[model samples]
Target chain A: MAGRRVIPGFGLSLGFTLFYLGLLVLLPLAALVVKASSLGFAGFAQVLGSPQVQAALRVSFVSAAIAALGNGLFGLLLAWVLVRYRFIGRRAIDALVDLPFALPTAVAGIALATLYAPQGWIGQWFARADIQIAYTRAGIVVALTFVGLPFVVRTLQPVLLDLDAEVEQAARSLGASRWQTFSRVILPALVPALITGMTLAFARAAGEYGSVVFIAGNMPGQTEIAPLVIMTRLEQFDYAGATAVGAAMLAVSLLLLLAVNLLQAWTRRKLGGA
Target chain B: MAFHRILRSFTALALITAALLTQIAGCSSKDGDTAQPGTSLTLLNVSYDPTRELYKEVNAAFADDYRRKTGIDVRIEQSHGGSGKQARSVIDGLQADVVSLALGYDIDQIAAKASLLPADWQCRLPCNSSPFTSTIVMLVRKGNPRAIRDWGDLTRQGVSVITPNPKTSGGARWNYLAAWAFAQRNGRDPREFLAALYANVAVLDLGARGSTTTFVQRNIGDVLLTWENEAYLALKEFGADRFEVVVPSISVLCETPVAVVDTVAMRHGTRNAAEAYLQFLYTPQAQDIAARHGFRPRDASVAARYADKFAPLVLVGIDSFGGWPQAQARHFAQGGLFDQLYGGR
Candidate 1:
């Protein structure tokens, strides 16, 4: 605490922190709210009321939720395995986890398109098996999962690594089974991190465009997601329409993820007490 | 060693940050430059793919002669993407002074939003403001195994044709319109033709270049409905023997429009240079160069220069269908015939 006196101190640090966050995040978001508000109530109702808009909202939310949920489950397992035990090429596997983050979205889209098109490698197999993926809603989910996995794994890795082992032992000593130790003792400690990871993954997947477009076939009201709808509006030079859709998406996405945030806060309160 | 290691890590981090910042900043400044009075005005022509060679030769000539006449620096910066996407970027405030996209409808979109163009913008310049025109043709593998002679051949089952999404790619619209126009001309219902043709499509790509790459480069599909210039470039690049260009008995005229982004022109005070740049595109020299790139020259006299290269055919204008606007509204526009076909399917 005394060392803080040598630094910028409490007042200046607090002011600088707020200023930085305001400039980087709040200012842009405020602009969106202001710009969107300019559409007025009647205009917004018309934009949101369109059947195409509703379809896009459904596709964006459902696909993003599916991808984030898939990531949370698999990412937890991958993070746990990496941390709890040793393995060959562990560093290489860890590096591979970050590939989606590093690869350009357009390049990823092109690669996914090539890999999943009807005549392409995996598509050939799927075609033979009579299970279609590319140019379908399933392709959108696959691309979203591919891009959002890194967020969950990276978030959960440290949480799992730092988890206290004695809690599990203590639970077992109380005659609790292994499943009980995991479910009751260890899982509570991980809830905040898991929820946070899921929220980030969902947000990332919701706005994703490039990777999905190639695989989606861009058929309106079919594989078209909300971002594609916005892109379509933009292409048509429908500025009001694009922003109208974007603002509606903003509201729905915030509402959809409110539960995860509340869960995170609850977990934080529990962890603080522990 | 410890000090060197720390220095190396800091240097690497700085380099990465610099690289990323440079890229972000490069896209940030759309176009903010003015030639001092009496200096050359550099014109940036951000175009779609395959214009690299065409623009290189045309810009060189424009710089020399424009400098000779007006002493302006005529620089053309052409970037290509799927046409509709490119037009969307332009509309989303890409600082393009002049846009020559793959279709006229995209230019009309810019005009609608920015009020940067006249109602008859395409006709503002010579030859309906296009200065050059292309036609859609079937790009088949060497020997043309599909034996596809016209648009009707594509409707046969299991054809596995490839085209870019019409909603996104300007070139793809021409492909869509050509098929639609042919169906209408042949007295077949547009929906019937469209449903069958779309069913034959195995893949939909981002733009003409992407679709062409899949067809010519990867050798994927039976027939690729592509821009004539792209087919020519493919033949020129990938040996003419490697692929065959099958001109459909009838095809839609792909007229690309060029225009100055007006507000940008007013702000930059490059109005004279911008207008001059567009007019220069129609000159015999430019038209001949366009013909070389497989675009039919706007000038009949200049087109004769490449007479040996062009195959004889009756060129049909959109005048038969009341030009582009009506054609677009009737065939491909939202709630148009496309939806009638795709919706039912």
Candidate 2:
């Protein structure tokens, strides 16, 4: 809480934030578990043990990991370009970077499917060239990449802006190479932001449904993702099956996110000490 | 302090820009699908989005005819989504006049969701009041490369099957029903056959069209469980040489029903139009177009002309499963047996 109330009702606002988050996020998830409790142990196990559920878990988390890893490396490059350069239509390019964040997941999915199908605008070219990007493991990654990019870019943007150019200049003054200054100084400050971005991206990709559904081609063992599987359970009225898969996914992702956040905190502290 | 003000202003500007963009987008969508003006008769037809074009044409025809006969304006407002979602919407008081959904059971959910649609509503209507029906057909590679002639061939180890999530697509119910029937006819218990069948499924996308993308666009599956009209459309849209329809030995009848939402119509004061609109669904003109779209016309003679399109079957209607209510409770209802078989871990 603020020591002095510069703004009226700071505590109230914080309470409202917690209450809103609790109502919207925590309660629904809790209800999901509560509803799932009606299922006995055998019932729960039966729901989770199905081949389809197993396959979906693999697709959801693995693709999310692949997407996060891929985005982390590439999103950094993209952020650097945006921050360091003044290109023609630079503002327009900046606006376009947020398109994924703005567009509906459903519309994005449909557009990508149309673009990358075997006979789609771009897909036709890929087919002729013997490359495939739609409806395989590749398409899921592409979708994850689509929704995840803005997170990394937006996260790193301000940090990049706040970064002191003098540090790089001082390193160069000390006869340190360009690569050495980047690898040691700039990269460290950006680590916390990068990890935050990757966490956001990974979490988003893990639960992503609409865009992935259109492009994933929904192959059971291969292209099937966990969210779609949870949906299938919901449709079949298998609330327990949906929840079990969801809970499992949440646990795994939470562990991963914890590790990432801890790494980020460590990085931030190191940068602070320096 | 001055620099801090600029930074705060910069964030405020970005938030404003995002907010303005979302508002414009939101307002534009507000009336994107508004109903026609000055229609004394309002008919709410819960339906699929793909059928919007077809319904537009049919509604145009119906409006002309309905106006000529009644001397009053009539409009059909179509609500589209996954049929199950749509059904729940109506059940939860979407104020639907006549419910034309992807399946009988979805309409049945309106009755089941509350006391809104009666439990025995199916029995109350003749032939369950299902206006139109479809069957599942296989969309194969342009040349049928894998020679996936039937459902059995789909299980030939390496043959991957692509279908919409049966949970979302009412048509996928036909797809699942057909698969079960295929297994049952082949002397395998429906359960074992389903497990094996789902084993070959590679991608279980969320909707029918999405699954079609997997088949036609991605070329991932050996066979695709698709609607009859969609199969016909795919062949026509893609080169005829691009896809072939494989009729199974026994096909499941996908009955799409329409019923008057008595409660909603009474509230909206569209009862006459709503009731007439549902009655008009059985008209000869509607049947013709319904048949043209590869949907089996409920009318007799028209179905004969189109008989060749549909495979001969033992007529596995929802009646065989003790009607819509029982079938819903047994199979597709939440945690129903189908879930146990397919989704159960």
Candidate 3:
């Protein structure tokens, strides 16, 4: 009885799930791996070991991490407001969160680049302060943050809405401070959702090219992203080299995502036990 | 929590389904259009960045001319992007009946990699299969406040040069080589001169149009090193009062080549139409259209008619550096001269 499932046709659904993922994701990844492997192990290592590629990868990974962490914090606040409060134009505000998702990324990148150029309205203020945004690593972060925001917000919205306010009230009634209520009573349950949201945001930002290309200064060793490095290789007609970089990105992304999943599962188990 | 999980999965599934549906629709829509070719014909012109306006006029004119000549309605579909990218698409099964890329090396690549056309495809047409030509030039703010006139002026301390990455832009490869040619003609070390010039570059946009935007729209760079036509287009599109074109003392001749993909054209039964279309580019009528669009016409009459539009310079052909293949391998290839220019520092 305990093992009996409420949903029927488990095997059929599971087969469909595998088929869908195989066709959409695994097939392309397999092709990439095959192309990258054609270069041989030494050739692959040589392609990935270049300093320019290394710098680009470092910039890409670090910026994506920063962008994801930023989205996680701000997205939490946004989701909290949408779920916790009712105000004038709340529905509009709720719909506004999806604009980043709806707007074409290239258009978003162009708009952001225009807004952040030194002569631009927002950038002129920064220019006065002698701080550059567009054509810098900071600009890459800004574009990534813009594109990844919706991922964090959409992922957290449901989890935030499902969060019971009674738990916080009960904790406060028991003489716990507000911070205590948040940190002790509420945060643990939100931990899994928050990590999942951040992971999604991180993944989205890591693979983002359309929005970052226009904003990134694209100096080979300085502001270039890993994806741009792949493109540069492709432009030179180095198919194997391009796939080598792509395979590296894929492996790194998979490992990071796997780590995040394990972390999420551990937190869920720990919470369930607690 | 269970309900939320289901909702999230449903949304993901729906998005995936929608994407697949669109993909199917896109594929199916292009499938049968060429099956029965008598009533109407389609020719796909895979081209590069700045040729959008040029081909827009050419394609319309050619469609009309073809219908009048053959009594068959012809629709020429145009696809434009970075030169190398467009070539790569054709190699990767884009089914283009004709390719008018920004450089011969790109067409050579399609021939070498895909074998869609013969190795001597350029010899198939006149003027090395280049119906038109252009030269690299400097675009500066009106009055030329920086007084940037030549390649040497671009490397000056205060002049911020805006040019696309050579690896991505066919025009930029010409820009790089023209600068190299200038250095060589002046007996300066080409590599050092290029290093200094790149040091003055404000941004390395991915393509020619992007660099034009960086210079003209974003107002970042002091001077833009670009194809002459693009510089002219920038002035014509964005007010000429704001900027001016500076013809350098020496520049590389950019012979944008056109070729019919023999295999694809034969497969699509568009061989005759495709060949005629390319041949039409050499006509005086089309040469006039090319001149108006800022391209240097091959026809002497058309070129003389628009003489003032193009400034005279010692135009160095690609043959001066062996050819496109050798030049590309030495300069734009991985660990080559262009990469070495900005590599370590």
Candidate 4:
């Protein structure tokens, strides 16, 4: 009786879910793996061993990590402000969070490049301090942050809104300080949603190409990202090498995402046990 | 009640899936139908960036001439991007009727990968399939602040240079080769000189126009190594008061090649219009338009008319480096000199 389903079509629903997932996601990904394998093991090794490819991979992963971490923190704050507060223009602020999602990435890239160029308004200030932002690694992270922000915010907003304020209020009444209430009470409850948001942001940033290309100066081994390296190989008509790099990116991203999912599941289990 | 709700959702989901499947089937069937040419002909001209303005004028003139010659109305659709990227699109089935790219090698890729044209496609047109030619030159900041004069000056310690990546940009390959040609003619090691020159490049854009924007709009570099026509366009678009074009001592004659995609042309039945369109480029009227747009005209008389606009510099042709095939293999190929030099991060 405890495991009985509410609706009686579980078998039908499960079949539909598996069929849709297999057709839409699994098939395309299997095709990618098949194409990559056609390159042969030695060919894959050669592509992965190139310094340019290695540097590009490093830049893509590191910048994506930094950008996702940044989004996770700021996105939580933004969601909290939107859901917990009743400030003027709060609705407008809430809507603004989704702008990055709606705006074309290429347009966002151009706008960011303009705002951060040495001669631009914001860039003028940086230039005065002898610091460069556009066309550097920092610029790549900024572009990634711009594109990945909405993923984190949109993912966490509903969970934050669903969080009952009474829990915090009760903790406070029980003589728990504000810091303790947030760190112990609120944070644990938010962990699963936060991890979900961060993983989504990280995955989006890792595959981002249009926005990063405009701001990333594209200096080989210095600012070039992995997707751009793949594009370069494709342009050179090295289809096998391009597939090899793509497969490597896919493998790393899959592993990272799997690890995050495991962590999320573990946290959920711990919370349920608690 | 719960069972009813689940049944309702399942019905809705099934409807959506059926609709999506039907839509997919419709799209696939539509694509399988072959395109037919009608009385009014439409040609897709896939060109590289920086040729947008030039092609606009050329297309307009060609359309008028074709209409007057044959009672058929011609409409040309233009698509532009980085040279190699444009070629890749053609290879990936963009169905371009004619491809006027920045380099012969890009067209060769389309020929080899898609069988869009024959191996000796260049022999189909006059002037080795190049309608017009330009050379690499410097667009410097106002007052020549860097005091940059030639290819050697570009390698100076403090001058920040802006040029596109040679691997993706056909214009950049010419820019790189022009400098290499200069160094070689002066008894300097081409490799070492190129290394020094690249060391001063502040930003390597993916295409010619991107580098132009970097230099002219962003003002990030001291000198921009770009095609002569691009430099002219920059000076004309952005105030000439803010920038100056400096002709280097020696440069490469960059031939802009054109080819009709035989497969697409044959399939669409626009082969006659496509061939005529390319043939029209060799006309004196078309050469005049090319000269007006800063491209060095192949016709001597049309070139002479624009002699004052162009500076006389020692120009080395691509043939000097064993043509596009050999040059592409030796320099821009994967793990070649370009990769070896900049591969290290």
Superposed Cα deviation of residue A180, candidate 2 (Å): 3.3
Candidate 3's iRMSD: 2.1
CA lDDT scores, all candidates in order = 0.78, 0.77, 0.90, 0.90
Model 2 RMSD to the real structure?
Answer: 7.1
Q: Show pairs that collide, candidate 3.
A: none
* Interface RMSD values for all candidates: 4.2, 4.0, 2.1, 2.2
| Per-residue lDDT over A82-189 for candidate 2, one digit per residue giving the tens place of the 0 to 100 score | 888889987887898899989999899989987888778888898898987787888899999999988988899999999988999999999999999999888988
Model 4 per-residue lDDT tens digits across residues A84-118: 89989999998999999998998998899889999
Over 4 Å off, model 3: A1-7, A265-274, B1-38
Better of 1 and 4 by lDDT: 4
* lDDT ranking, best first: 3, 4, 1, 2
For residues B3-53, write the lDDT of model 4, one tens digit per residue: 688789999999999999999777544432232333467799999999999
Order candidates by DockQ, high to low: 4, 3, 2, 1
At residue A97, give the lDDT of candidate 2.
86
- Relative to the unseen true structure, what is the Cα RMSD of model 3? 5.4
Q: Give the 10-residue window scoring lowest on summed lDDT in candidate 2 chain B.
A: B30-39
User: Candidates' TM-scores?
Assistant: 0.83, 0.81, 0.92, 0.92
Clash number for every model? 5, 15, 0, 0
Which candidate achieves the best DockQ against the true structure?
4
State which docking tier applies to candidate 3.
acceptable
